[model samples]
Target: MTGRRIVSIWFPRFAMDRWRKAHADTDDGLPVALASEAAHGTVIDAVSEAARKAGAKAGQKVTDARAIYPDLVVEASDPGGDANALMRLCKWARRWSPWTALDGADGLLLDSQGTAHLFGGEAAMLADMNNRLRRLGFASRIAIAPTIGGAWALAHFGDRSGIIIDDDALDGALAPLPIESLRINADTALLLRRLGLKTIGDLIDIPALSLARRFRKTPDATTNPLRRLEQARGRIEEVAEPLVPQTVYRAAQRVAEPVLHVQILAPILADLADDLCKALEDGGRGLRRVRFEAFRVDGHIAALHAETAAPVRTPDHICRLFAERLETLDAGFGFDAFALTAIWHDAMPARQKGLAEDEAEGLALPHLIDRLSVRIGVGKVRRAVAYASHIPERSVVWRPALEEQPGVAAMQAPRRERPIRLFDRPEPITVIYGTPEGPPKRFRWRRKLHDVIKVEGPERIAPEWWRERSSVRLRDYYKIEDEDGRRFWIYRNGLIDDGRGGPPDWFLHGLFA
Candidate 1:
């Protein structure tokens, strides 16, 4: 009772014999069924004992199997249906124990230690499981023992039926089983038989040290397979992959009843959120996004996701964000359970609270950005970030407004002024009466003539000498005023000595006022 006990079930020819029958109305005792894609097409993947007796085996070419038994019936394997079937079987097996896994395509392992008595005695439990499977039209062989190895052997190669190994009968039950039943390949089995180590009992009688030395060429030689086999008989530990993850570090509360009304669900959701928030805050981590999965009684799962502007483990704030998505959940057939999980968490950093309203207001900017982004689409709202480039087009970049602002130490807010209306591209405005040597005094711009009343000195900005200037022009910008009381910022392109072979031109760049 102190040692681990496990059960392994093998469907000798699950996919093949799941539905195939030897006769139309009766069971075919002599006819063995196999499931394969190759009847007259490809090779077989599974074969029954009757088919094996008729010289048919797995991986035998369809033609070869037909040569042995022409009347053999084969069907293509449906892997998807097979998987769904296995999952359904796993669910049914859960009635036996909470721990069970689909061991590959055709087998299952159940850990039934403390849970066995719930179904009666060990013999009765084993019989009950096997009978339930049989009633479900599955020809299954189930084995229960103190070790996985023993159970596997009993299920696959004992008396053409299954065996149940309790502690009292461990040695006696495993005495007659073959060493090959330990799951050695065909080649290894033949090699062991050649070495006069055929049955498990035969291999057990040999001294471990001698067997390792005598069979130096075999795979089992290194560890003395017999000793390992014996050690596994009653003292081995059973590791079961639970159908659901163990609820240890994680906590969950499933609603047994479907809650269609939001009023009823709101409090329950809020409670769970509060619990998670407390757990997260205590751990010094903030919640980034929380998922609420609603499992409906109709077997469909609907999920709602809420992402925060900042890492926050506040239950009230989290619940408010999720409220937006509650309308989308149909609650069809009613929601049977509600599950919540948090992702993208970060440790909440220690910081001083802002005493002034404006200081707190700046901190809330990121949250305002998140709300704006949700309303106008994430792409439309963002902070205007200034860059170090002198080129106006490359002077700024847009970023997601919801992202946390860079630490104040890393960002020095630009001291220079920014234009209220910046055009996508600077428009070219023609100006007359301007020469390359000086700024435009009186110019005709936009088909209107303006007389210069006040003028400023030209600020010459020359293009780099080695850089290509095919699309760019060297300019001397000047602030000017017209007699009508309008101010204009104008620039004259191409100095007299400029290398580019073009006449100097005047263009009005921007209006000063």
Candidate 2:
């Protein structure tokens, strides 16, 4: 396999640029600084280029910066907002490569291994990214290398904005860079500098054991210099988890005239759904969850989501689900664009239409479940499936009806009877006549008294022994019918003083309907 290629885009003034964009209308090329409260009062966290040229710098006291430049614009630094904006940009960067992740608060990493050829070459791709970001009011440094660590170091510290370090020249490209570029902590960097290790080349020839012994106080402490060196040289593998996109199949349409009425959305949604379904069909997939997005002319967005019991490729079915959720969407003034996306999907091969009427009728249940799930949120519609555990409570599991559930036939056969409705936590009841191992003749449950008309079982269940330090006590269950013909499944705690606890307690575990 060919070697992996990684690209790092560093936004040196991300926070300041975001602030500038938020106040673009009022900004008139004045020096700006984002300030945050520090131990010694407010200090500059980030500064614009104009502010940097005017004797203002990060870590400088706000009052000192103001004294240096009287007209400097000061804005409170919002680290969270800056991070969120960078994540949004990471989402937008998916247009260039699907594998893109946030490097830090002000940087992004893209795995463009096999994707660079799509946009001519790595150089062209970097140029395009630079141009687009520049247009978006962000000054970014783009660097491509054989490794993530190398790309990151070059992007932030290299003299060039667009540097492509080839595998053959990896050592030469990184040799002249400062030790700080190795991504060591400030304290470690300071220590390395004090030791006269000013460049990456200075540390490259040092013994790994010597370096570790000098820098690390304990044997357990990580050897940062050696690890960083290995990563930059592409010796150690780096794994990056990219941010998941909301949808795989998406279709959007921009309208010349804004749509104000909900009635007009049906046809638009149908058309978008059809397009999305067609794409799904071509990819041999079907949608399990879908979302409809409306971008308003007033710069607001309204969204509606729908889920299905099974993967569905039918456009009409998808449109119907959106139709049910249309009223929930507030279109604001008017919608200028509409987008339909299949957020969750799965591979679904085409199945033949049932030849027999009964076979075709069997499919209606899933469709009904889908409709109900869409109507009353997915969480509200649930189904019960047999669980593998022998314990009564652990023998059954409840999950969303729209989700795929394990078949009952696949589970171990129940050795004893189980109630139809099982309470999550068994309700404690007062027994009138019962032994620690016997059934109760009369019980008080939920402030209601019930006299036993017929008694059945004394099925004993023991705690699973394989589990480590199992605290579960032994249980003796009984199925009894009351005077009103109501049946219940009740159980007693541990055996009468089995050296576990005090007297055994009774609990109404479930009700049989």
Candidate 3:
């Protein structure tokens, strides 16, 4: 328990607590029960302490409970609401430890190793946790131990609150506890109890070979009691998923009071931007994308994101990018914490700012692109970037302006003259040539016959060998001018006697102004 300190918290009356919180008008002495619809009909899901004392218990038929105590108060239970509430509590628990998670439906797990000293040692930390939850109207049973399973068992089944189990006392502490405390399923517990394995100590006394033979070793420990026991005794490592992501670059501030508006949040966001920018500059890195989040007092997080057209190191620029979008935050019950993370970055691009007006104007465009993207959407504002393909129609692609156009696009091989307007898909045309494989003398396109005044070429372009099979056809492109001086970009798919098919098909690919 001293090495990897784990904290397990159980909320025995979570559903009833939620119901009470919502219906504050209810008298505390009233016998309240939360009911749910089952195949057998309406059944009690959870009960208040007053109801339990009044002879009403969970899993009882609502009609029977009503007959037993006709004055009992019953409301439908919301399983989804209870689960969401638990997850919210898990995320909020990160205020004490970053490694926190929802443990089942009514518990929370926290990897509180090395954090106890911050809150004035282990006992004080537990005391603080109990006080905080009491203020939020939740009753909690907490325990800290060396392993996750041990902590969980002690918290749920231990004789006292705030139980801290040391490594040497782990066996003694767990031995007397019921086997169900190991988190095995009902069926497994029943099977073990039938075999005279009533307590954790009983399982420990069984031969290891017999235990393995009786229980199937499955990944889910709930079905395999032996595996659950191993995890509890620290024979297996327990991995708990963290509630918050540990981003590479981040800045956060916890406030004394909840902030209600972006006007109040702007300055805080600016400071975070400045700090993040300084760190990025030191590492010779730049912010390509950032996540700005507001943590609400009610446990909901309102998040916004900003992406740049290129690597940016300017704090003011980053702040400006998130300015307009910040107004959209749903600050329910207001936000008590704010965080910014440079989730995506790249090596800063080297640029020499010359005194020339054109160079300054060139830098302005990227800034403009970034702002436009945040205001509208990243996908709305787009630009063209070259693609690595010899096929004329596939040579370029449209992308979001916020994404940097790869340098390879600018350094690609020079291409031949292309038309100003390209067709989305080629249009089939009929060509009349003097020879079977010769240049077209005339062509009929859009139901109009155009006499070829000048035919430029049979520019041979082979299929992309790497992308297509060898059987794929090649193209013979041509620039032709009609008698009326209209220019068209056309190509013949395949070749005569190519052995793959019949005669080649001619099509119009583009148009020239």
Candidate 4:
């Protein structure tokens, strides 16, 4: 079978390169080395070509290297910065292939099966990539093979740096490489070396069963070697996990001149919104969250993000939301490019409009909520949702208005007389004329006296025995109205003398409009 083509790009001095670029302004034409802390002392992690010529090498102790060459420049290694720089390069590589991914901290893998033709075939693509990296101040060794594993091994171990198109020549090409190219453990490699099997060709003729039995003592001794062998020979599949794009729907444009005024950005954003909405419509999807980014000429990026209450695909609506956020974008030194992306989306198949006019009106509330949410903030608008608890306060939850509501099966049983407003914590009240087990007749709350003129009977609600122990108090709630027509939901905690605690306390829990 014809396997997929893979390209591996390895940056041998990735960390050192990034460090040098960060200090480019202060860099003198001297040898430099990056040191990482080891158990014994700081060890050289990477060395510049000049440093290597000056008798400095990786793995050498820093103090010894300094003694050898006192003028050698040393800086602490930054592994994280290297990884981030590699990822940024991966993103920039999307111009060549969408399936580019980081192989390790120092390398990248690009599945270029059908993409090489776009850049004038495999050889041209390799040259193009090498030239681009050179322009970016990165030195890369690139190799192309029919398999990911083969490409990776060739990039790091083989003498060749260009395309390896003849699959039949793989064994011959890989035979002369050291046994360490198979990615086996140091112990296994040492054992193989001792046996005079110092190359992949030395073991290929041996029976698989014999190899397994001979190396049974080593962890994954048989499987690891055999798997790498098969992978290198293209006998087994090598799957590439590509990086996930930040957005599903994205449109970006680079302008001939940088834009400084917010008014110029408005038109550009509107056009991007139109393009994004069209793409969403084609995909039968709608956006819930959208982001607009302005990449400034000075390397600063300004972004504006907005959320919608419902799935939306109209350019007009999207543009209006972005207009509200345009003021927040700082066009530092002017923006060179504009990008609009749909960060979050949902399926929104087209539907026929309702026959009744009220049906259309029903949608207005959600649309209004979306607009308001964009203007203020999503957290500022909330909607009540039924929760799965029997306790009054626990029975309902308040969530962001734009969030998808829970399904019916996930909600608690319908409540018969839930109050319009519930207090975060029940307020303590002083009851003057109420029986121990009955609703209060007169109460003083918040420095005001209330004479109960109308009263509803105790709706006894037991505590959730499954979740909490029986020692928890039960509540007998009463709906009472004051002489001034103010309504309150008061509950008596614990039975009058149930032995759970002191005499039950009267608390005002909720208010009804």
Candidate 5:
């Protein structure tokens, strides 16, 4: 086809086919029918091949059908169950084309505009599509044409199903089809037939003014044949929304047979990662998160997800993330199809690579964090976030790296120089103060004595008088460098002769980088 190509698929016995597929152990030759209650009586909603051969059909009363065939197996119809399964099937159809959606309750619509070449050609694409559906235990009638309406018409009423119609031949191919192929309801079809308009050709020849007067002018008038005719002729465009929105970065694989082990999926997973990453690189974007879906033949999907600490387009990094999640993955009845998509992404502008493996500027921090997250868990890796407090321990809290810590407005960095490393609990140290309320001259810690070469501060920190008892003591913090140039953060616990304590004691709290 020229501009755009579409594929329409219809399931003639959708409910019955799905039911039989689920119960493969049952006798295939037995007659089966799905019946639902109606105002008049219980009616057959769908029938299997055996049931149809026994003179049973949809819309026929259950009693009447049973009258013709005494051994017909009757089961309650499940419209809701069929619909939910169909939606999943629509998503699974993405393995063939990203642009896929439910055509109706028992069909699918796909845009084949740019995807045909990937499957060889339009014919090979249809063959692959048919083979996959058949393997999944579905019976389908599919057709490809330049427009949605044309494809739908040909799939349902053409001389042969699974035919591709070129744009140049769409009119000739659609002319001989019955008016009901336009997808109008029975009443509308009956109305057209009564007016001697029995074929699409007849309706096409009718004057536009006459066709307009015969139907309502409102957009809700789905019974309008004129619109369907225009759509089929490619004069009017019909929009088909995909089950999953399109993404620039995606890759998928379909196997001829279902795979049973997680180990067997490694190469396929790697290939998908490489394909997706290549797409991201070409698009000038990076993947922040990706969704992995494995479609099983029984219609159940097994899904897993992974994300990065920073935007990335590396295949090995992406593969490693998924590898961590594969051990516990349950491959129910195995999987026949697999797909990958970068659901969340960010702009990854090109940059020059540096030769240094150790980055002092912290350029490699994100990669390190990502690796740690994968090894332990995505949620276990955390960083220190400062909070609004004066107490050394209360000044910051540990939180997950990916999670955004709440309001830093009330929090501020310490204006004073602080050690990069801090102790959870202060250790007691022996100190000789030059005088009362003065900085230390020497200190003994871990059984080693160190002479002070320089002293910076007696930064005063008052006790929380509101929350503490009258005995709570204030603190005098000092920044001192020993003679060897090794710095230490030590504090005097109380004032000398203060009512709160007999004498101030010194403790080493932290170390400088």
Candidate 6:
């Protein structure tokens, strides 16, 4: 009812992925067409606007497109590249308005009410957008209107110079547009055309009951043309497709000129960090990880990344963290602008911090640990406490040094008592002669044979049958002392003289103090 404002953005060659493939080395001024390769024949998926002007249409076979122009280049559709390009456009469009939604695969919709004044005015904004896109080698069509639907209709079918900007001329502008401008599926458009309703105005004038009666055969068929027309005006709530999966916590400052020197970049970087910290403070949140993206003039980007141990919002702390990473930035050619983004962050929970005078040695220990980790590598300086499980392989586990150590009972809950320095894997030994239940008087380990001097009891231990009952074994372990006062823990394999195999295999498992 009041002054309505909208912007429709079109990516003309967005669907013609074949043109993209054929012109991979060069994507400019090429006649390109995309086709769906199937059993019947390859049908045109999409064609460039230039190719369309030369007589190309969807559903036409590949042979048909080539028949029109022998030099026509063709390729299969790449849905992924199209999707990625759409997302990048969405991110770049954030410069225009914060609220921008993907119009479809090849277009975007912007609610341009009071926000159009930001780029001088709606006309100037549209001109600026078109100019920038042209400079970047992309041909785009932009349309502004009183409603999203009207803008879409005008952008796709109106005069190439731009269209429908007057406040009071919305209906007159949209009146002549065809029904296909509503962006319905191909089947719906064909059915509407068959019923002698080729334009939106024709569908709007049709009686709802009569139209419903005529198309009652198909469930997906439109029954109420008038009601659908009202919905087409974007009056109802429409879910927007977001470009990014999550909301980004970011702050950036566009430089007046491309900065080539590090001195020029330092203050900007510090200022951006300060601004981001303020934003985090406003939301009562803190940052754990942050990345700085340096967008160059040539479309190449360099990124500097940093992480923090605790939730930090102070500008000084954040700036210091980025200091080391900033050295990694490569200012090839020149960087035009810098943008700071925080990836993994969390809210600053209510916690206690000791007063400056009463604070103990907390900062010192953390600083020491960080330095050690940087020098020795993060994974090397970790706390590892291996446990004693009935299964030898499950005996030991490694815990991160940063994590709090659990109670002794939690660590001691293993079913078996294992030696502190147990070899990673047990080694088999050749014993001259030994009973299955007794210790070996002499054994060969690593080809060196030693005779046993003192012998202890034969404690029996059985394998857990629940894991594999068929392959279970009973072992008789002995604590024995050799001739040179060298003590060893040895275990006899299988049952005591069951005659299941030859003489039992002796395994010198571990060494004693």
For every candidate, C-alpha RMSD to the true structure in Å: 23.3, 16.4, 19.4, 19.1, 23.8, 22.1
TM-score, model 4 to reference: 0.47
Per-residue lDDT of 304-340 in model 2, one digit per residue for the tens?
8777877888888888887877877777689999999
lDDT of 5 by residue, 77-184 (tens): 999999998998888888778888898899999888889999999899999989889998898899999998899999999887689989999989999999999878
**lDDT for each of the candidates?**
0.67, 0.82, 0.84, 0.80, 0.83, 0.68
Tally clashing residue pairs in candidate 6: 3
For candidate 4, what is the lDDT? 0.80
What lDDT score goes with residue 195 in model 2?
A: 87
Per-prediction TM-score: 0.43, 0.47, 0.48, 0.47, 0.48, 0.42
Alpha-carbon runs more than 4 Å astray in model 5? 217-221, 245-513
Tell me which residue pairs clash in candidate 6.
Answer: 386-396, 387-395, 387-396
Candidates sorted on lDDT, descending: 3, 5, 2, 4, 6, 1
Model 3, 317-430: lDDT tens digits are 889998887888888789999899988877774455675532323557888899888888888999987765667767777888876443222225546788889997899998
lDDT of 4 by residue, 468-494 (tens): 776889999999999899899999989
State in Å the error of residue 356, model 3.
49
Summarize candidate 1's per-residue lDDT along 1-513 as a digit string, tens digits: 326567888887777555453234644545444445634667777766677788878777868878778977665656677778788888789888888877768888888889988978777888988888887777988888787777778888778555777777876777788877776567667878888888888866654434545545565522346434644464323344567754321235677778786566677678878888777766777766678777788999888776666777656666766665677788877887777678567667544456543222234665565556655666787776654334444456666665543211112434543344444455566555654477665778667888888878576655543333575677776777899988776667767656665777776656655
**TM-score result, candidate 2:** 0.47
